[model samples]
Target chain A: MSQPDPLADFFAADAAPAVDRGFRMAVMEQVARRRLRVELALRSLATLLLFVGVALISPVLQRFAQLLGQDLSQVLLVMLAAGLVAYLGHFWLTRKPVLRLPHLRFF
Target chain B: MSTPPTDAALVAAARSGSDAAFARIVDRYQGPIRTFLRRLGPYTSDADDLAQETFLTGWTELRGLREPARLKSWLFSIAWRKAKGEARTMARNRQRDHDWQEIRPDCETPETERAIALHQALAQLPPDQRAAVSLCLGDGWTHADAAGVLDMPLGTVKSHVLRGRTRLVEILGVDS
Candidate 1:
């Protein structure tokens, strides 16, 4: 008896109609847009956190100045700016070389 | 000299907020993703929905991937899970029907008919066995690759293929 070619038959039977490239492009575009929105949202949240942190701390420093009798606001502003610079430096360092990683060899 | 970026390159770019890089990933894997979904028994309409969800989940979770070279397997693993979940939901909704007509195609050449029969025989096997056979025969995945994709032990995957192939040969009335 002949050995039937199951794999050949399977491929022939499963050959679907060609997909519309335009439809595929549209789907990719939708995904891209969604990713963009997510990144934007993350950046916006980071900015908001930075602003809120500074805003809340500024008033506290001003109140402390009344008790200490020193120009604590100027000192606080410089410290805040310096801290922001350090944070930016850390972000830059972490963001560098964001692409290279070891490939998984699962074969 | 900077070499042209590969798919992994594009994926990294996407992870770091590059829209174009993300689009590249979507473009590259869409066909394979769609084919995988189709084989999992989803109708074309529902296949599209599941495909979208698969890519979306992959995009959101790409950062967790330790090895970018295994991207195809990773994507397939996600697609497999999504398809299985959908199948379970579908089975619950249509519990009364023993025979699922979705397994048959409208147009059938003699070759196509035999292929459908083979698929039907395959569907009768357990999910892991069916998956091992499909990945090996349909997707051209090696036994080890199929094992990784299915999260099964290599020996388990080999057994599934051996048993699944034996059953397929029997149902197709082919001599080994």
Candidate 2:
């Protein structure tokens, strides 16, 4: 027969919390969130690098545009305006009122 | 009955980005890890948080674990480090006092008194000694296993366990 161990008995009284479904879900949720963050960060980095590369080559592109009798600056301005309009259109369609202009606020 | 997947298999799947496999690992070890943290002095209150952080660290660094067979001890080591780091900055003494007050009742039972005294005596021990006692005595871990998790020498772990057990018995006035 084994003798009663007081120390072990004391520890036994302080029972461990039951392993529940919630803990595993919580941990997996964290892992998913981490994965999402990493993906977002990488995408953002790629976008930034693309933008920097375009900016760096703008001078050479501008010279080529002049030889072709086209204004690169105007083309770039039109693209930027299109991008802004698309962004605002998205916000408006999504019902994000904060970005709506005064006349567009009602919609 | 079908046997559950082995640690190595689960670890390999988890490293391959399978959430289900990692969740299995979490389910398998959370109880032991939390209990171990609770035994480590003054960490009972935040053992859940420590356990969660340990899992999160394990998830992010899964690929770096050289030996998947050592996953259990690796997780415990991570948990031990998290508790130790938190213990240094948190006002744990105040929290321990508050816990005592919170558990106080109009009628004090012998079990309650013993529980309170046991935690108090545990709090009084040095952190390393307390960790040794908690892992080896409270959790029934082998001395070598405790030593690995604690990053302590085998001799040091044995010594800490012996001295820590002696101190606990002396303080609680209980027979070892």
For each candidate, what's the DockQ? 0.16, 0.23
lDDT of 1 by residue, A13-81 (tens): 664444556646666666767756766777677779989998989989778677765576678788999
lDDT of 2 at B93: 68
Q: lDDT by residue for model 1 over B68-143, one digit each (tens)?
A: 8678899889988888888776566453223554656678778768656655666567767877877887667899
For model 2, how does the per-residue alpha-carbon lDDT over B4-83 read when each residue is reduced to its tens digit? 99999999998876788999999999888887777664555477877888999999889889999999999999988898
Best by TM-score: 2
lDDT per prediction?
A: 0.72, 0.80
What are the runs in model 2 whose C-alpha is more than 4 Å off?
Answer: A1-4, A54-107, B90-102, B105-117
Q: Per-prediction TM-score, please?
A: 0.66, 0.75
Worst 10 residues of 2 chain A by lDDT: A98-107
Candidate 1, residue B125: Cα displacement in angstroms equals 2.6
> Per-residue CA lDDT of candidate 2, range A13-89, in tens?
66565586887788888887887787777777777998999999999988877776647668877999998888888
Query: Ten residues in a row with the worst lDDT in model 1 chain A?
Result: A98-107
- Scored against the native two-chain complex, candidate 2 gets a DockQ of 0.23
